[model samples]
Target: MPPIVLTIPEAVTASKMSRTAIYNALKDGTLCARKSGRRTLIPTGELQRYIDALPPYTGKV
Candidate 1:
């Protein structure tokens, strides 16, 4: 089973997004995360939910 949460760097890799983009999403309330001491973790389920909520994509041009 996948871990319940992912570190920022791990989330970036898993989401295929830049660190800035992740931070922007977090700041804008588009994504959710939890602070564990000094580390911020994004829940795997939240990540999946975010992806699931995105509009359907067309094929690459």
Candidate 2:
């Protein structure tokens, strides 16, 4: 199967998080992305793992 990779915009949308947030996550070791020429791509598998590791959502007042 083709490796599932997402561009910055696509990843931002997928994660519902800002590009800066994504970059910060990468810098802090919470996220990992690959740099190809002028583009940064995030592997879908890694993205999924990150999501799965997130704390559960809690509705709050």
Candidate 3:
């Protein structure tokens, strides 16, 4: 089966970011998205790439 594109709410849930943060990232070119008519969509692969590109987290000692 084919993967599904995510809507803003879906992306928020998947990325665990606030709506404002997602919009900011989109505005800053950190996250990629495409418009289909009036709906904004993020490809599953693109979201995965963004997550994969993030640096690893290290907790404070």
Candidate 4:
């Protein structure tokens, strides 16, 4: 079974995004994160939703 939540590094891998991007999203409020003591977790569903909501590729250079 897949994980219910992912660490920041896992989120970066799953989303194929840079760690900075993920942090930026969290800082900018585009992405939501949960606190587990000193750890930060992102729900898999939320990550998928964020990916799905991204603008479709137009093949522009």
lDDT of 2 by residue, 1-61 (tens): 7559999899888889888988888898888889999998999998888878888879875
TM-scores of all predicted structures: 0.84, 0.78, 0.82, 0.92
Q: Model-by-model lDDT, in order?
A: 0.91, 0.87, 0.88, 0.93
lDDT of 3: 0.88
lDDT of 1: 0.91
Across residues 4-35, which tens digit of lDDT does each residue of candidate 4 receive?
99999999999999999999988988889999
Clashing pairs in 2: none
Quote the lDDT for 25 in model 2: 82
The TM-score leader among the candidates is 4
lDDT comparing candidate 4 with the true structure? 0.93
- Compared with the true structure, model 4 gives a TM-score of 0.92
TM-score of 3: 0.82
**Which model scores highest in lDDT?**
4
Q: Pairs clashing in candidate 3?
A: none
Off by over 4 Å in 2: 1-3
Better of 3 and 4 by TM-score: 4
Candidates sorted by lDDT, best first: 4, 1, 3, 2
